[model samples]
Target: MERTLVLCKPDAVQRGLVGQILTRFEQKGLKLVGMKLRQFPKELLEQHYSDHKERPFFPSLVGFMGSGPVVAMALEGIDAIAVVRGLMGKTNAREAAPGTIRGDLGMSFSNNLVHGSDSAESAAKELALFFPGADELVDWTPCTLEWSYSVGEELKG
Candidate 1:
């Protein structure tokens, strides 16, 4: 199983959409290995969004993210990073597909409701930023794994 980080952004939390966002992943057969609700510190936000520091939306982006509690989740499944991204749809809510989380619940570009790591490298870095301790993540097999993947498939972490 591959693991990836997913965040229910402040807007999602504020709008009470965290449950629905999480359910979408769960129902997709992804296993939740770790999760927390937190009001992140500005320093952490800065580090997390460091790549966007040169972008125009950097300040407000960090501000909005730190404004309230956000749900950080570590999910595991086959190609979990890509899977989560597909569930989240495009970053700009207005352009997201109708069946996606953003398309269904969001309207603004800046206030898009969720975030998911886009690649293996990003997943590692973002997961570390959100879940630093080795003990923070749990390892377990979901009973539905067999049903989710083929009998001949190889499962890995």
Candidate 2:
């Protein structure tokens, strides 16, 4: 199984969309192994967005992220990284597909409602940033797992 980190940004939390956002993942069959809501401190944001530190938008990005609380989650499933990203839609809300979360609710690129790790490597790093000691994440097998993912050549029940 793959694991990914998902962040319902401050915009989503402030707008009361945390449940809606989480519901999309749950309905898509991803397992929520860990979750929490917390304010993003500048130091944490620096590590979380280290790749973009030199970019011009880094300051604004950090400031905005630290402005409010965010819902951080660790999701596990087959292709969880890509699946979560797809559910979040394009980074630019205006360009997101109609059925996606950003397309349906986000109004701006900077204030995009959600953030999903872009790749497995990044997922591990991001998961560590938001959820230290990831080993503690739950390993419960969802009763509906059989319906959500294939097991070898067949579905498991």
Candidate 3:
């Protein structure tokens, strides 16, 4: 199965939307391989958002992210990265589709409720950052696997 990183950002945790966000992914058949709730260090946030270091909002972005506890998750499924992104909707809440997490719960661009890895490379990097130890991730098959994908589809994973 493909794996991806998903984060219920500080705003999501602060607003008590972490359960709802996690449910959306679970109901979509994504398996949770690793998860934790914690207040991240500024240094970790800096490394995680390093790509945005040159952007004007970099400082504030990191500040907000580290302001409270975040729910970090490592999920696995077929096309997990794309699936999580679809569920999260657009970065701009106003532009997100009605049924999406952001569309339903978010109200601002900076305070968007969640984050999902945008590509395979990102997934790998983010997962490693959030779940550094080899033992951190769990391996198992979901009972619903058969119902979620066909035989041929399961073979792809």
Ranked by TM-score, the better of candidates 1 and 2 is: 1
Stretches > 4 Å off in candidate 2: 134-136, 152-157
Tens-digit per-residue lDDT, 29-143, candidate 3: 8999999999989999999999999999999999999999999999999889999999999999989999999999988998999999999999999999999999999999888
- Which candidate, 2 or 3, has the higher TM-score? 3
Task: lDDT winner between 2 and 3, please give it.
Answer: 3
TM-score of each: 0.96, 0.94, 0.96
Best-to-worst TM-score order:
3, 1, 2
Clashing pairs in 1: 1-156
Model 1 alpha-carbon miss at residue 62, Å: 0.5
lDDT of 3 at 32: 97
Lowest summed lDDT window (length 10), candidate 2: 148-157
Every candidate's lDDT: 0.93, 0.90, 0.93
| Model 1 spans with C-alpha error above 4 angstroms | none
Predict model 2's lDDT versus the native: 0.90
